[model samples]
Target: MSDVMDYNSRLSDPASRKFETFSYLPAMDAASIKRQVEYLVKKGWNPAIEHIEPEYLMDSYWYMWKLPMFGETDVDRVLAEAKACHKANPNNHVRLVGYDNFKQSQGAAMVVYRGKTV
Candidate 1:
């Protein structure tokens, strides 16, 4: 048996336009996204929005702003930030990221929020 672990990031067909944690799974809905954020908050993780502009779609690096929603209990507030980021960069690929300071790493939920069409 071949021992190979698929840990490196993956990309689906450009036509599919689906960028999710699991290549085959659909992106999480609003409710699921909220639950994830709450879970991370309860675990003492700080939330932030990151993105790669459409012009930089080929670029793997994501730009995370300095503003992070630390100690935020309201999911709406966090969602608002994500929405605002999407609104500003409507053509970009935005995502929600939670950072766990205690572990010095990111949380499990890395939600991708495809920008709105304005």
Candidate 2:
């Protein structure tokens, strides 16, 4: 169980199209998103650094389009906070990386803000 505790190793355990950033929106439909992530892990919301990435659940939508979540249960501090939020938004246009299906790396995302391209 050592692919960083195996949360599907961050993607691609036969997942044709799974995604993170829940609070519920856009509907990628993982069986109603695994019952809303098992009701946010039974309302405990584990956090070695807090924030389970949902963008805003419903009204203030952000990354609900999918592939923008974040995690770091601490390791290199989530790549130094996704490289300092992608160097404070370097002309954002769809950038979020946390490989596992890509191979092995985990935590942090949100390299999008202005150069716009949802």
Best of the candidates, TM-score = 1
Best by lDDT: 1
On residues 49-78, what C-alpha lDDT tens digit does candidate 1 reach at each position?
Answer: 888754444566788855778777788888
lDDT (C-alpha) at residue 34 in model 1: 80
lDDT of 2 by residue, 2-39 (tens): 55432332222322222344312353343443343333
Worst 10 contiguous positions by lDDT, candidate 2: 47-56
Q: Using Cα atoms with residue i matched to residue i, what is each candidate's TM-score against the true structure? A: 0.72, 0.22
In terms of lDDT, model 2 sits at 0.32
Candidate 1 stretches with Cα past 4 Å from truth are 1-13, 16-23, 54-60, 115-118
Clashing pairs in 2: none
